[model samples]
Target: MLCAVVLNAAQAASAQSVVVQPAVQVRSVTTNNVSFAEAEVARSDSVLIVTPRLDVLTVNPGYRLNASLAADAVTYLGRSQADRLLPRAQADLTAQLVERWLFVDGRLSADTTAGNPFGVLEDESSTIFNRTTVYRQRISPYVERELSPRERLQLRTDHSWFQNRNAGGTDTRIDTYLLSQRASYELRPQPLGLRAEYTRDSSDYSNLPDSSVLFETARLSAMYEAAPQLVLTLTAGSDHARYSGIDQRETLRGFGLRWEPSERTSVGALVEKRFFGTGWAVNLAHRAPFLVLNADMQRRSTTYAAQVAALPAGGDVAQLLDSLLSTRITNPVERATAVQQLIAQRGLPATLASALDLFSPSAQLLNSASLSAALLGVRHTITLRGFYDRTEDLIGVNPPPLFSSNARQYGASLGMTRRLQPDATADFSLTRSRVVGFGTNAGVVTNNLSVRFGASRQLSLRTTVSAALRRQWVDSTAVTNANQTALSFGLLHRF
Candidate 1:
């Protein structure tokens, strides 16, 4: 979700059960340069960061609740401007109000980050150039009712807001809301079904009101299962959008297929005719005991507000929920066996990694594709990923006609994790990316390499000492080359 995959064996080893818990971490970090710049502009600093985290889980017969909360207090030596206190929290709830009749699901989250790169908030690190503070919050709720044994109805609503203030005293804000309803019915005894959905979306911008938009869409779909492993679908829809008092409408038709010949392999594709042009989407995935691969491509029209709201934060919340659910097995041996059963039973691909790119605050037609693969072994792991994206009808500073331009981006990363001993582990990764803007903006290429060595040992029954070293590099158009080195030591106590 953060444009990168972080495989932590340590987390996997500790994810045995879900229970209410509180953890405290006190860390001290020393860095040679925190500005992510060359020696001429770099500044050295020492910071003490303390994080208090809490995990709450309540699982009952008819409802489940999961929540996480953390607060970071950062103190910088020599009175630097980068010192601040930050709080982040996320919560998810699912409840069955009436047995087999009514259901409710909801999610709420709030976080702060450094900047918005691809309409998503990018995490803060030593290599980040901009220090802008962006805060985001989102709330989504869904309700479902069983109309009959073979019929169902659902309603969903989402609200999100984002506010950011740059170092240069510039502030921006965006608000978005969406409401949708879906109905599904089984058409026959066989594997045939019909579904209809209607949605309305509205977005508002404090700085760019002209860029705000209101859109509505209605879709009808039919699906037939030809075999246990294959299914076919057809969809017809209409979309209407209004921007700055201008209305545009389009008719959409699409056909799709889903094929999974084996438990470890899957392929899906959809081709559609729309107002902008012909659009297509494809997905392919395969998984094995030691390897996993996923790839996808899509073309569509979207707004910046929608993209931002859809983007994930630092981690994959859905995957985290899955992991938490999987931890219900309290016995160690049973938990291990359950993991194997899950691996064998899983039929869907994992979430794809995020791509590094910039997003504009305007309605645009976009084409994007990505591929990610990973190999896991008893003691080592390897990962590779790449992506490409292009956009048209980009909004510009001048009014009237917007700029029609495209950007190309591609990147790959290789990483390996090894265990030195029972209590020590080390890993290293290298990533390279190139972004070229065709019509506007300067082209930039970036290379980043990082290595971390972590050692943890128990000091007592409930205390541990952990130390790590992280080194990173960055090359960008704004800054030719820069390097950062950091050493961190932490003490953790669990209760």
Candidate 2:
């Protein structure tokens, strides 16, 4: 359905001149796993997956469009119940409906993944890597109008849905929606600005009615530019929520400052007070010739669906920097080399070079802090990062036997990546996490180590062969001791 929609939109835009690109891939994978239970009673499986992808881009003076679609067909060698096809699609559109006065933006995406391991797309380290698949869809639309030269108005809405089947042979569904509007105006035309905004969020769960929530918030803010490198902001707000037929209201106020004294350094801080508690946040970042640093701390109240919605929408900063560097080089191999050289020259930290996939979303209010640093070398890179989080009223199992309790989590990771040759690269990482204060799974520890070596060589004008081996280990109270290993080889021909 999503592919059809994207194709139709592309066809319509092609009438006015649009660009389209397509790609295809075929891969074979074999894996052995000893999951949960005793190590002696593990399971192994072999599978093959084939994928085809398409990308379309349309651009003009007043409008732009980008869309991509990929379909994956999986076949199990001896397990007929674990074979299925999945489709992933994404689309983004922006248009200037009425010159510079009015604009529109929209995005749509759909994905399918295994429910265990928190539906992570590429990793299989969960205790129960079941065959059941979960499907998720998201849509966002936004509009903005220029009320005046120094004033603007905007409106945005988001809708997301999740569907899956549980072990009890029942279907589960979750729906979430968000609506917001904002108006901003310059107060004195000299670094003074004022803004007002309103936001509403709603979440509904088919199997967990008591967990549903509806919340509304309104805020007014004032900003002053103290100097060329400093700015201050103050905000006052109120929140009203309805949960399980109970209504509650709270007052909120906050102060913030942003300072950037140099080209390579920046600092930000915010302190807020609310009826339920006081929250504070801080961020510091610096880039040097040989090192990069980033640190942050935050305290906030959020629900499960809201947290999921707040996940990063784009790739990490490292990937963004690589893309920017790629535009300067025409050759694909040279672009990769230039990106690595630029990363080393700019002292891009190790923590920012790779995505932080350790954190897990929980349906609880929490306070968290993290620090990451990266050291770039001539031919190698090293990174270190740590995080700590404390959750309030953590939700556990069901409500019958009461398995919910508060918990604290902390973790650290160390990683290194090296260029073995012009066409070969190697990466290694080790991570450890611990959870405490939970009811049954108190003092649970998980450790994972992964290493991969990849090389590519052209066989013909449009063909290449690549191979890799991956090993992972998971140790936890829930999963006991489990080990997984996989070796894969693929042949690709692009046109």
Candidate 3:
């Protein structure tokens, strides 16, 4: 019970739903099946928390092979028509070394989403939002050792290489150069915890149009349950990120609190504040069996940067800069010049220039604010439900924007669910999205409609279908939005 509270607090602390990495400001999970990032967010990305057993395989004293396939269309955004798919068919080999002191095991997996970078692989895969296909030609290997029942250590690794991608687009083609390590420890006698991780992502971009950004990361966190109804947590971390041949450092310092009043009632708040000249935000949330509510108000300010060969590179690092930016090497100094020329030759886009212009001193409020509320109920007989939330986001130019130039987002959503049996259910929902801002795409309207059917019992099969349409009141060179619709079918088995 205490462990549950601590986990909830951790999610409340890391609620942005976005992490800026060297490769990209990843909004969703990529290759790692285990969603460390999403776990920090407010919700569980996994559709099925437990997979039911169909049959069991036991070889001699310490070996087993279990098989099953499952899929579901998992979406973070209520309006996103693009959902993920995961059809997992796997087997395992286990061996016992000592009574309970130590043992090692490995597994191999095959998935439908192994190629086609933009392909949808899982109907309920956690990486659905990324829209990237991850595949392997042969068997994948994993090793596990038991340190104790409550606390354990693990070392797992995998390698991949992608092929044949359209160059007119972005990051494609993978290289077998990335390696990662993870370790987790459970605090004794109480629900407390600590974790550390490091990784090197060096995928090649030869098949794509963008440069491959290598990501190196280090992180640590501590958490504790302060009371039966509340939990507190602290996190500190740093990332040395390199992108487009340029290096930048990202630091983190955050804290959070969560309060659960009863089995059916809970409230949460989080503060993610950074030391850099960046920005910070606080999130508040409340939930119940039949109702859930959320509100987010955040502000971020950025500096407008300019580069000139005439500007002094003066500093103790000048010697190092000279060596790093040699003609033979693709370095920051040289790349800065090329980017400067590009901005000068074409003249930077007005919209972007205006966004960067926020850095200038302004008397307006630098804080963005909004409110959201949603309600849902089910009679348990027919399985009926509905929900809605509204928020006003002023994100354009610092806070208070131009007063007249502010970006306001208004969203309204309604949904319902029904049960066909004790094991099968169906859901249907419709959503409307509107945005008012300074850009040409401002004052836009988007509508999303969807339906889903699921089975949670034996011979599991789940599927969902949805579509989205976006319309802009004013014409713009950028995409107004794309019309998307997808369907999925999946099965899961366990032993």
Candidate 4:
């Protein structure tokens, strides 16, 4: 069913509208012999302006701007009596400048929140309130300028800063800046083009033992259509990174190509060389009717180096040989060897460097594969897929119970996705994974089950629900170590 209403009686040539809405949510959690529930109610209001004339701001440009301002506040159960539910506010303005070559956009947002852990407060385990309000604000501004015909240049800069103050005596701040320059050239229209870009990144940290880090990257690429049905692309780039106060340096050189013969077929490959870095990898994937497969073969090795921020012990001595023998100094501007820079980079202290070998990069090999197939037939409504995968990482996040000389993972999965209706669908999947650590501890195995249901009616209404369950165990522990469950539901309406 469709309903349409039209009114042409507005007195002005341009008009605006304001919209207000509200919502409420309830939540519950059960974990590790602990169960809790909470409810929250929120109110939101928004004002929007619609310009009927194309030239609402300036008659010469012939454009319109949509601007909106919104604010919301929510109150949740269980909180300190002195605390207040601070409201969040936002403002947006999208302006069309010159209607084409140049445009501007801006947005601002702010919000606050409270603390958690009810038991800690009730039992007086700690004297602290464990909660404090934080203020977050941001703004984004951009401009575009056209350089010439057949060739164009673009420059963009972004700046952001954050400050955090604790109720106690703790305080911290962050400032970030980014700049990008890009140029696009049409060798023979857009079908054949060349592109180049360069970017620089720097970070300075202060507080306990202040430090700074910086990096520069540049890339050049060309893409062209060899045939109406075939397209090819190639790209090359390099990156140099320097750790802040540590004065440590890392660099990477990479090149790759991608080819697409038809809408149904594609292939791509890439290789990279690194300086004072980890390792390298290879990846590949292909798709076909009734069956789809992807595989990745990779090797990675990193030194058991200590954190530069907390240097403990010197790592394997082989790093000295790797650095002196492998890395070559090359000048970017002169395109010549620059052994002086290499010697300078080597002078920095390794204490504040990665726990890995400072002189050499670690190496590791990893492989993974996955597959899926159309269940019965193309005309058959049901689809089925099965996938298997594995990974090999030398280090684990946890050193003790999860300790390993090399970590290995294995998994297999089965999935069924079906169309229940033109506008609705459902899917179910199950997967099992096993992880074996190189250490003496027992390996772990986990099984995951999930289901999803979704419905959509164009722009009017949509609903989706997904649920997951999992069981995990370690080879040494014989119990149902952990049983987990989760679910999410969402609904959206447009008018």
Per-candidate total of colliding backbone pairs: 0, 2, 14, 15
lDDT (C-alpha, whole model) for all candidates: 0.57, 0.56, 0.33, 0.31
Which of the two candidates, 2 or 4, achieves a greater TM-score against the reference? 2
How far does residue 194 in candidate 3 sit from its true spot (Å)? 6.5
lDDT of 2: 0.56
Residue pairs that clash (backbone atoms under 3 angstroms), model 2: 349-374, 350-374
Which sections of candidate 3 miss by over 4 Å? Answer: 1-178, 185-210, 217-225, 229-231, 235-238, 249-252, 257-428, 431-495
| Per-residue accuracy of model 2 over 60-110 as CA lDDT, tens digit each | 555667676776777766473366776766677766555565555566665
The digit string of per-residue lDDT tens for model 4 on 1-495 reads 001001221221254332322222121211221111111221112111111111012111222222223232222223322323333343433444433544444434333221321111110011122333333333333445545565656554433333333311123332222222233333433578776777654433224232233445666667676766444556566665444222333444555555656554566655555443433344443444433333344333222111111112112112221222232322221111121211111211111111111110111223333332223222222222233222222322222211122334444444344445543444444444444434342343323222323222222222222222222222222123222232323232211
Reference-based lDDT, residue 274, model 4: 44
Q: Higher-TM-score candidate among 1 and 4?
A: 1
Higher lDDT: candidate 1 or 3? 1
* Stretches > 4 Å off in candidate 1: 1-18, 116-136, 145-150, 166-170, 173-192, 262-266, 285-293, 311-353, 356-359, 373-376, 381-385, 391-409, 438-464, 479-481
Using all chains and alpha carbons, the TM-scores for the candidates as numbered come to: 0.77, 0.74, 0.37, 0.41
State the weakest 10-residue window (summed lDDT) of model 1.
1-10
Instruction: lDDT for model 1, please.
Output: 0.57
Q: Between which residue pairs do clashes occur in model 1?
A: none
Candidate 4 lDDT for residue 323? 25
Ranking the candidates on TM-score from highest down gives 1, 2, 4, 3
Give the higher-lDDT candidate: 1 or 2: 1
| lDDT, model 4 | 0.31
Candidate with maximal lDDT: 1
